[model samples]
Target: MKNRIFILSILASLGFLSSCSDSYLQEDYSDPTLISYDESTIRTNQDLQKFIRGLYSRLGTSSFSGDYFTYQELTGDLGFVSARNSGYFINTNAENHLVVDGGASSGIWSSLYNTISNANLILSYEGKVPDNPNGGVTSKALFAHAKVIRAYNYLALLGLFSPNYGEGDQSLGVPYSTTYNIEAKLPRETVPKVVDNVIADLTSSLADFESDNASAIFTNNNSFNANAIKLLLARTYLYKKDYQKAIQFADQVIDLGGELVGGGTNTGNTTFSTIFTILGENNPEILFQIEYNNIIPSNNNLQAYWGTSGAYKQNFMAKAFWDDFPSTDVRKSNVAWYQNNATTYPDDPKPINVKKYLNGPRDVILLRKTEAFFIKAEAQYHINPATAFTTLKNWVTTHRDQAYSKSLTGTAVLDEILRQKGFEFFLEGMRFTDMKRNNKAIVKVQKANNVPLGEIPVGDRRFIWPIPLSEIQTNPNIKQAPNY
Candidate 1:
């Protein structure tokens, strides 16, 4: 099968060319801007930093910005788009949930690949940056940062598209594009190979950061730095099923000591509301986020999709998920609200609206310390159940449900951790992957106006998304996901 691979032209990366025209092989090209910039365009640290910022800009607008989270939430058991409105039909089913081309889909596959391709281009110029005689550290740091971006993008692709690393592993993996060769039709590597590549990139990048003794190259958690890198390590290890390694890295972050959920607030009933009230680039808990500079002209999709005052509104909580929370659970109070025939879905019987994203132009959190603690808890459960339950109890009791006391042991302990993660992360986009990772059957048995629409069993093919049709048409080596 052939999959379409969109490659940005070299001139376009230099910020000159606008769009490509047909019949490019005529050889009488008259684009002057493309001819001006050469190897010297990115020789210094300033030039490299500017290019890096451009890569970050791509991240801001990509499907992962807020669209990815929205799609994930609706498809998961925690939330569902109303069946009354055919407009949200794509989000209602597994088949059209996310796509590589066109209309209402998340459009993540292409957006991520574009960013990856650009990172590859920037990395190709690593040698061009002059080495500092004092230590050659600045040039090395720049190169390492580029690797971090590449690794981050690749991991995002793997998480959504490819199967889990262990038993759920699909032999096929997304193409690892590490070069700026547009004509290159790279085949999908195996799942292990993809994981290895990400680990290799992060490992090398961490080494470079240590060599320069640079703990942080960027501030405000807006860019990838040493701290963010460690968080990524913890998350990656968790996905890879390396419980011990995941715990080790999570410990590093925990020991470093920062606020739990973005600010130095007590983890009581007020924790969720307080932290979200002031969420921004400088939030202490955020290890990495997509930042918006201005508060007034915010283009963040979260504000529109989840924001209470914003125009668009179709997303609502699954009642079963809401009912799972204790009556006094602060997360339930802070994260969602009962909107009775208010706007959008009038047919919904007091449908729950997510309130976490009410204010925007706020930073879109990609990683936070709260998640680190949860990762540690889950990892510990697999290693030592007693200690894991203790950790889980302490964290949840203090931060989440104040009255929460459940003597969970064995498999129940793991279930509790997953459940806590669902409540904490909520719509920040971890639900689908978490369910899949644990091989949990998605039982959306809630009666939405007395309708039983969702009940996906384990080993169901719909759980895995189809490879975008465009990809299958252009890249001859690409294979669609099994049972797609």
Candidate 2:
């Protein structure tokens, strides 16, 4: 696990646009002369595969794929109540705060389009792929990879700064672009349209003819299976809030030797915190993990930001945030480790600062097995409260089916699921995203010990992030989401 990684993480954090500082901002990527055909050789799979690898390279990037946000420090290290990472920290420094737009806002905006430009070429060329005389498909590997990557790239943009799931035509999203046309000026497509396109692309990718085994889940392991593609669909469906679809895709992975891990009922050590540790993924519970070689010159995630001691002191998680965890659960250590400053914590929330993730492998776990369970629980909660209560009870219990002494129903169950989700995904760059999706509020502790309100209710617009400003200057085709 420590050794595996994609060609490289091109999507996470590289301060791509942040470095430009407006002086040469427009010049950084303006010269098309760099990637034009006449300047280099790329006409076939042999030549084109290099470009495919490049797309993976970009997805692995520190800046775009967004590794910065996951690191606790950047998110907790801020001048305000929330926090700010070097990259665009949605917690603060967003349009709401109106300051220091860490090039991330536009960097992700640009990188996705950059990857799309490459994907367009592959898709166009994919149409002419000759039928393999020996087997079922000749271009299956690259074509499938391209379409999924392209669709995913768009979704990444959408997640960063678009409105809720169904907001279409009226709500702004990335401008739909398939070609690398310098003059291409496409406004943001509606949310519904983009998601439909993403589904179509991924579905098409799954259907592609694979003459070779190019589907690799683990990077160092270097093997691509249908499982990765399937889970991506599962993830996409979850975002769409299509519970049944999420269940469908998740089922595909489980059928392919994927199973949940936990001691039967009310009795296993498996919980939120342990699931994130390195040993956690070793279990079948890991559906998908962003493999990182962690080798210096190759690929490194936001290791620098979360670096325990080499850099600045660990950006400790807020004391109050960690206090909510039950004292008996081991997951507490996984969220935030306590420090000498623990005494400074506010009294109202009364949570102990945790020491979680201080010691774990650097590879990013994108999707885990427990999430499938949580998602299933979420879908079932409203639709089938009976099943939802059962699932919720089983999940929190020491053992899988052992009835919990305490339980919830209906919205109460939904609320519990969200609370655990927050504890589970804290600082994973998901708490904010999930909160927005559920329309949860931001309960800030203006005074250290004051109990403000139950939930600080956020707006629907808060769900999507603002399109970083840098992208608008160069790509007119890109449209800023509304209310930015």
Candidate 3:
């Protein structure tokens, strides 16, 4: 039997508790309904192909324990609300972890491990593929794809669970499980080290998959192709503050001939809707996206971003930076909701509810070309402002000039650059992370109830959300984030 620790690591995000038994991780399923891994029936190529599709199906769930749902749901500038409170939901801008809140907590808690376990399930069965028809040396290709997804899931997990990048390898992090065994539950590695493992997994994944799958196979850009995988690597390294690697990888994505558009960049018949729309898999700007149908299949972030009583409604943008958007910029043309009407006693409605994922159509937030550009610009500026400014100005003007009345250029350009980013991303589950990374502040000008917006206070410990309380309790191996 596999060790209990490893099993929990695999099922940790699946809402499954280990209690004391380790077999849960390695337990062979008797139910034909649940992923059937019978080595005997897997004789034909089609059978092996079926297994691969099962892997894909598992990776593509609404409440997936993976990065897409978690990042959009947790960590960002918003907060989840009391489920009983008129179904009110929003990304509360507080650092207090919400492990006990049953609804919001479960998605953040169970989805990623559900994602991670599926990857391991794929990895565990790959060696046996030769017995199956769909089993070619491509088994290695499938394995790499699964690992890339796993790496993406971990990146999201670390964004919320792990602390700073400087903590290096010694900083506490999540356990490592490749074989899906329960016994091998790895202890907490440091944040930096955890990142190292992510890099290592990604490194292997890239090496194995790139030559084979750079151009996405499906019409919907859901799977992790080479370029998309590269983009994720850049994002991961950027979080780690490994500027050179971040730049290197981001450059690779840019070289693929894609760039961020849509901020007055694209001109023509239709302008971007201020409310939720434009999430389909076909958008040119979308380099990669998690595919979902509004009704049948799940598009997790959609509910959060465009949901009525959903979390997005709760996380409407703060007016603190609203004026930052250029007046002429069509990008500001109501892409989200902010109340212009004021009631008696100075009551104005919430402002920042970005409708990027509304029900009209489409799917998840795409890894846009703009994000890659911003990452490169930020990476450059971190070490040298002049070079960074030049790169940024060029990107902004060449890419964003369509909407803006004037071009931005000056010493104080970071805000301008970030301002566009705010417009480009906003509620895409990135604002909070960007705020933290760029060393920007998260101020509350007035009290929670007070309508007044806050000042620009530096991002502090409160800025880095505490790890959810449940993890600390169950996994004594991990420590609570400081000041929790």
Candidate 4:
């Protein structure tokens, strides 16, 4: 039975259960010949737990957890592909070669949908499984956990594949599904409708937490919990431009504790960079992270792409973006010039690479408590600008820099808040989405010319990634993004 369950996990991870075809949109999990055992295999809550672990592993894959960050940063202005390195993301750095069949588009699209399909299957066994033998993992908790994963994947898909929520209500959102119907032909939901669905899933999950007697047992930094759901709600509301609700949910996260991981002086062993090395094991600031180790190895290429000692050394921080940081800033420790003689050009100066993931097997952080502070600051700016300024000032003083005494009012306050956020989450994959949400243009920094490349104007068709050719070919109801 144990061997059968392990085989089930392996098959699910390889997409055998999600789809027999190339496109995830055509998933057919009900086909009897595909699996040796029926739904009876998942007869216990422990069995459901094992199955859900597969979904978490899928989330940790290169397509979803690893390259997704690289795609976001390279496409944005903060990072650029190095001429002295491998050919990874070269076209993406130049903002060219984004087509329907491109790997960047298809990889993220397929992986997310596959995970969602698995979550739907897990949610189907809500009441059928018996109570966990270990206790504290009720069917209700398991169902809520599945809902959070499903909603998170949908939210990620919406951010990458659809137009920004601030674009317009009628903008197209990717197809969202909640059932395991093999023959279902799902169409794209509008941005507004998708947001509504995501919110409904999260809200329903919160209710499940409230009703579950063993809810606290499941709420941890490694898995979905009430606070993680609240953080997602805050992010969704922030993207939707609903500031009041954003602030409310963000405050709930803040009130729950887990202070930011830096002090006024970053002189000690515990600094802002410690957040990455610790892997959230005992870290209070981490709300949730996708952990990777020897047993369950990480599929992300962040180490190879960003680390100076990486195998590929494919990307580096833009000089212009690096100059924005002050020497006093502790976050500067993560950015260093590539010094290896083998990779560096003797004539050309060394380029700066992010050192956040210098060693392999680093965990991918999905949500942090520090984000709540930023969200509250930004959301407060919409409601009360002066309060927002104070909020930003206090956070910077307490955590980032004690000498950070910039007195600004009006929109400048909002600008500084975003700038700090950009610094805080440089390689963690928040910059591109934040830029899109604010309708900001991408200003590429040209290395040879030392001048800014022409900005990719707001609302450019390229800003929204193309729907993969596979999905377009298989699903007639789904339409491609405009102009792609």
Candidate 5:
């Protein structure tokens, strides 16, 4: 059972050459920019820094994190592709005839594996690279950083390709490789094993940071720090249904001076819209993001795909969904009606475009503090319903809707928490995963025609993406999702 692994070749031309086994070079590579490298290229602390930068570059690409959100949005129940524009993800939007060979699965799979392999290469230098005069970054710190990247990417792979955690001991999880062994053949680990591995890597990383205060070496939100790893651990536990652990980590983040962007008020200059407006700039709420600038602009089609004007406007919000938002809600400003132009379908009438990513060359936020509040609220619901109700009500009243006074109880408290989180994270790509983990049906409405696209029932095989056909053809060990 040999599974194909796409190992990245460091940019030798850029003073870094991260290479693996010679046999891997002979094989067909998924990314053209990926060339073979020599392990000796990474000798100094500077070289190690360059190598980590390379990993971030790969992860920041549209094919990986960018499309990650896009594909989920297309498949999720939130919105649909506009018929008035370019034919992007229309079939996905309609939930029609999804095949293993199609969708964003292949690119995402290759990109993530490439990142994991490169992270492994960095981890290989754990005890070798010495602290340099330039920065006090220790080899131990670099190794911990690699572990966080590898573990986080593995978690992302699981969310896309595998069933929800705790499904069963036999439920298949994606194949995970810890070492830089391109020739190694591995079978899928169980879902629980994969979750355990993610937790172990994060826990180990946390210990390394806590022992020597190594997290101080990396201060940017783009890099993984103690809080970022904590957030990821919180999310993993939340998915695994370990409520106590989830609340534990979530609280650690919240209590550590984590504040919302708008400060829970709409009267100030720093309102909810400031999160998107100050994309590349620092925001207190953002724990982790993929930074982009004029030198190296984001390739993510978020701005183009969701833009109200121009040829690339393919996706828009459902009017019914938009109408449901209270007029006083601060988050409702994220959508605006598309003014008719030569390119638009005039008959369509009042199509709304998502404003979150309209500004290009901005940072793609992956984790933030707002999610911590939601995680704690939901986790509390399972443990103490009364406490969860207060948390939910307070969060909504303070941050989102100033006029929100819903008297929710029991299951309704949990439902409102999810609904508010969905609205908070709209177009940021948390909706589909939220629906899947909670076993909620995907109820999509057509954006153009206002037609109900039919509900994808809970636990439908379609919810689980098929293993890419390339992997199937190349790796005898790989197992496709059932009924794919």
Candidate 6:
């Protein structure tokens, strides 16, 4: 008998733990039903293909549980609640990470772990693919894709739930799982250890992707491929403060022909608003994105959050972020603002809503070459500020506005890079991480509750998210984040 690896499925901490000996984990099927194999049906190419497709189906979309945009922007300085509602936005800005069973934490925790579980399931069946020279079945390709997705999901999880990774600090991070089994009782791993695990996964994934797939396959960035893995590596190393390695991996992506999304230096594509305007599979600038259409709309349509006709008009462009961009900058063109007559607070300026997620069938970018450019620029700044300045200038001039110019050195250069990053990625869900990494404060001057918004200073306890209550309740070994 094959050793059946029973799954201890924890659905977003839904607490449905199952075991191999437990009949409760097994379903009694009196008729024809789907046959699942923990180890037996690993021999067929069709089975492997089906398993891989299942994993992809579970991958989170731009909106919904795995919606990176909402989770980051709502908590950061760029977003604001124009009209208050007792929903996710309120909890997010209030720093309610301990309410693990609801809101962003619930969705993110469950969705990411679900993805991780599926990846682990595929990996459980490793070595089952035939190694035919004529390419009967490619196990390496399967493993690489699975590992890459797992690594990517874990990175996303850490970005939101864990504290900033410090070299000497031993703060806890989310549990690092390789098997979906009784090990669900495991306690949180240290941040450094989790980072190391993520790096190892990406490293193995890159080697596997390179060995199993053709270089030409990755030319299209939609799929998980070698270049995408390299981009992830770049981001991972950047977080670890390994600047040289970060630059090396980012350089690999650029060397693989990653370019900006526009048609040419200045006279190409649509107007300067092409990044937000253009959508679908043809957008050349996107390194990796989630495309949502009518056929496959399982994801949370972001339109509901920022659309003109959205249910709650709570989240809008904060005045601080809006004022940061000069009128000459092309990004300002994307902002659509209207006066709020409902409240007489804060001395009145029109609250702004971004046009990035105007409709449902839009594509959401998770990783793009533009991010790689920023990564490279930051890494360069750490090594050589002058060259970094030039790179930053060229990036803004080419894509943002022709007349934009800023000259600075030392700390100013770093500040400018992050500031520009904030504007460039406005409403794209990258601000909070940028703010944390740079040790910047979440300063807000506008009034929401009849008082000026107070600032969350750098290294505040609020920056660290609490381990979801459900996870703590279920797993006796778990500990809540400090100061929660």
Q: Give the best candidate by TM-score.
A: 5
lDDT by residue (tens digit), candidate 2, 1-484: 1111211122112213222232322333333334334323345544444445455555555343334344222222211122222333333422243212543454555666766765675566665554345443245576777777788678776676776686444457667765545457677787778888888887876775233555531233222245666777776787788988987877676565534433322223234334445444454555444443333121223333332331222233544445545554445422322332434333333323333344324445555545655677776764787787777676667423233366566677777777766655555555555555566555542222222222324663444556666666666666665566
Better of 1 and 6 by TM-score: 1
Model 2 lDDT-worst window of ten: 1-10
The residue-level lDDT of candidate 1 at 214 comes to 41
lDDT of model 2 at position 224:
29
lDDT per residue, candidate 5, 1-484, as tens digits? 1121222334421222122322222334345354434556568876676667667666676354467777777777766777665777766777763578866677788888877877887777777788777656666776787898899889888887889987743468989878877766667888888899999999999888677555453344777778888888999999888999999999999887646633344333334566665433477778888766555566646777875643487776665566677877766643322212324544254555667665666677888888888899988998988899898888778776778878877888877887777667777778788888878888874455553464679878877777888888878887788888
Candidate 3 lDDT by residue in tens digits, 1-484: 2233333333332222121332323444334244324335344433444444444455555344123433443344332222222333323423343434343444654567666776776567666655334333355666677778778778777765555577433465665567664334356666776688889988988887765442232445655666777888899888888889999999987887645344544443223442134432454555666545533334544455432435443334444455566544445543423332212212132343344454523456546656788888878767777777777767655655445444344436666666667656655667656766666665432123432342335534544444555555566665554455
Candidate 5 or 1, higher lDDT: 5
Alpha-carbon lDDT of model 3: 0.54
Across residues 159-262, which tens digit of lDDT does each residue of candidate 6 receive? 76787778224567888888856346877888888889999999987887777762222223545767777888999998877889998998888776535533
C-alpha lDDT of candidate 5 relative to the true structure = 0.71
Clashing residue pairs in candidate 5 are 19-37
Give the Å shift of residue 285 in candidate 5.
0.9
lDDT of 3 at 173: 66
Error of 5 at 195 (Å): 0.5
| Candidate 3, residue 443: how far the Cα is off, in Å | 1.6
Scored by Cα lDDT, where does model 2 land? 0.51
> Candidate 6: minimum summed lDDT over ten consecutive residues — where?
8-17
Across residues 217-248, which tens digit of lDDT does each residue of candidate 1 receive? 34456677776788788888888889899898
lDDT of 4 by residue, 43-97 (tens): 8865665566556666666365677788888777677766665767767777774
